[model samples]
Target: MSDTLHPLRVSNDALDDGAELRARMADDGYVFIRRLFDPDAVLDLRREMLQVMQAGGWLAAGTDPMDGIADVSRQCTEGDPEYPQVYHEVYKLQAFHEAGHWPQILDVMGKIIDAPVLPHPQKIARLWFPKFTRHTTPVHQDFVHFQGSFDTYTCWAPVGDCPVELGGLAVAPGTHNVGAVVDHRFSLGAGQLQADAQDVPWLTTDYEPGDALLFHSLTLHKALPNLTEDRLRVSLDNRYQAADAPIAEHMLAPHLTQDAPGAITWDDVYADWTDDRLQYYWTERGGPVVPRDTSYSDRGFADALARAKRGDADARLHLERALRRDPDSDRGRQAAAALQADEAPSR
Candidate 1:
């Protein structure tokens, strides 16, 4: 971060009441801190995510094919091995859905969001994106690219120490309050707000494998190009929204897009009815991909679980709406269970 950045300070400690994390998010729209996962856990997840991507198959060209994984790694930390193709392959592995219910993510995330008091059923997944010279995420708000809205959090956790060489992320924090405005000259990315305007809370910090960074829906953020040859950047985006949330009309558009890639096999783990008629509401509520994406005012999350258990077709819409992102993930068998549960049961 430039020394000119706003001189605000965070506890950077293990977390007590979670007030510190919440306050920073409520006030700034973004927060960068360490300690989302342990060293060993981060290493393990890194290896697993890479392997999962390899198993998912790859696109003929372009990184968007691996955007989910790269995005997570960017939010967390990763480096590319070589230009054009740092990673042999990278993709959003469906396996991470199992991470949704992990105890580590639940206990830590629950504390931050004040769950139980808020009481969310909690869902999790890793959105991976691999990047290289030929494929880098263009500067754009996530809402611009995906069918989902910005009403949910995209908690980003690094699988390893994320240095600049490793495709570190740069953020224009607090600028999130400024809606999706184009034109870099007037955009925070260009750094030309008002003459007397406050310097954007810009930062380009290196995070350890276990560290995490959280950002809001409107925040201005982008991933650094993978300049490090041989290092691969693999991360996760844990999305969340309130239960019973509607499906984003934007997301369903893919069903309408002629050349859009194949659709995800949305599996509803909770017992419920699958209703394609149900809408997938776009959301951008969670704080960031790393910190506390959300904290409910009541037990809306609990009610959501009940709706899902009864066989709700749009569970993915709701789960993505209220998810609690996790860092310690290697779901070989665990992921299988989550995906299995997500499927509709036989009569």
Candidate 2:
């Protein structure tokens, strides 16, 4: 007996601007589909992905082969950000934003989730979780670094059917309105992370590929473990917005570095952002930063940023670790000084 309304499909049981589905999302805090992809599209996407893995030999969190059609494009990798698996060569592909690599994959996600978000911190990434390992994403909201309101829903669309034993996503229902954060210093990896089990009831989502499971930023979610036999799970997680909701990039700023080296112009990416339609959306959110330095290390920064956005106090420690790793960075130095000052009183 669910109390919330789900965002059900309009004409074909396929989810649209339906009231029930929206209600489900608003009340329950997540809307998951057991399966949603056409076999053909899933097959094609997998084939293309394989080509990318074969070509790049490695990939970072937001990189994919489709984005690397160009001779000198960006590619994702599992090695340290500073010294990737292949240290000498710069593999971060510039083509991710090019709109060619896995056109079908992105397009389908857009149609389903209604919000085709950029997967990369910079844009939608074709991340390759390290072999024999899975990413340990903790429970938190996606609104901070992600552009737009916290109401945004994520559609984790894996390429294959994702069963619980195969590294599915775990989420706490009816927790979307749980402020921007709570306490979680003791929480690590999976489990409640200092939260009351009764306060937030989590659902283990066992979904299939060609389909997606949606969750709000405040849903208190984490990536499930992948201990399946031989087969690995892959997915294309997209975010959706109500038709009236503005595009994500419009809300989050350009998500860019000041450097113009491999920068892709917004003018070409999409048309509307230039006229300050974007400026209006970010009235309080602020605009893209003219990164004083691009040498910022991401190792622990992603976790720290996610934690800070969720209002976790201890996230500062990871932030400090990240800054220590990025000695020659403006973002780092400022962070270092702030971290030292914050800890000064206790010492």
Candidate 3:
């Protein structure tokens, strides 16, 4: 699926030039910087994350955890029941959360935003398994998921060297210039939604450790499928915005905490943390918080219900996940109803 890929324009040359960085971000909707972070630091964090996975039996026996040799039998994603069991353990890593606030990233984001920047509290990590191409992240604007301001930026960086076969992110340059959210439909991908981004030229590269791809919230982007035989593709998906810009209320919590089966809480995440400095540090910072718009997800669910009625297997799986995640929630109840309707005998 990554057959047609162009090299991203390297923006490290303008690292110190705020005017040039802002100019390029305005023109291309993204800034690709090679080795944006210290390679050793990235590797250190990768070791920490993968070790947690290894402990959870997600990695192959006798293999070094640092190699990220995934046990494909344990291939489950965010929506799957098994994912949270291990993911919540990884979430407790202090280093993992600290990586989101790395000074270099903050510095560049401030320059691009032309204001003091706030690294979003709900930091995310994509721990993708190989041979799981069907669950690869789909094309869509970040606004559909992170909703706050169109000025919000997602800074994605791999935890280790990520070749094309390992599946990193790619962007359709200047797509954010559309200046508005486009139509999205149900998807079995990470976000459970996909935007149609056909016929557009895609830009990506064989990303090395510390390389970062920063893009606007409304930019069209997706992950290239991981086609490797055994390795897991791990990456950071942290968001940032002007310190005074509005933020969605959900962005204040730990990422995907509500979506996790038992619903992970900040207290659970901080119980073992040795440092408390970053804990709730954003409470006094950031701009006014606003409620999240549910329209995007509401439409996606509607699409899934229709598709499931027509016997779409992926749609059925998505709904099944919703039901299993929280049967008492409103969406979970709707999923149950739709599934029951689909299973009813034809009259």
Highest TM-score against the true fold, candidate: 3
Candidate 3 differs from the real structure by a C-alpha RMSD in angstroms, to one decimal, of 1.4
lDDT of each: 0.42, 0.45, 0.92
Q: What TM-score would candidate 1 get against the native?
A: 0.50
TM-score of every prediction relative to native: 0.50, 0.55, 0.97
Per-residue lDDT of model 1, residues 1-347, tens digit only: 33643322443664655787666766676666566556576666566565544444322223433222333333221211121132222222223333433455555455545542111222222222334433343244433323133444445666666666565555666666766533321111111111112455556666676666666656666655666533555555554443333324333231112212232223322113233222222233342222221222113233334444544433333333223222122212332333346564751
The C-alpha stretches of model 3 lying farther than 4 A from their native spots are 1-3
Count of clashes in candidate 1: 72
lDDT per residue as tens, model 2, 200-282: 54566456545556677667666655554334345555554544444444223333322122343444345422343322232
lDDT of 2 at 67: 34
TM-score of candidate 3 to 2 decimals: 0.97
Distance from true location, Cα of 43 in model 1, Å? 2.0
lDDT of 3: 0.92
Candidate with more favorable, higher TM-score: 2 or 3: 3
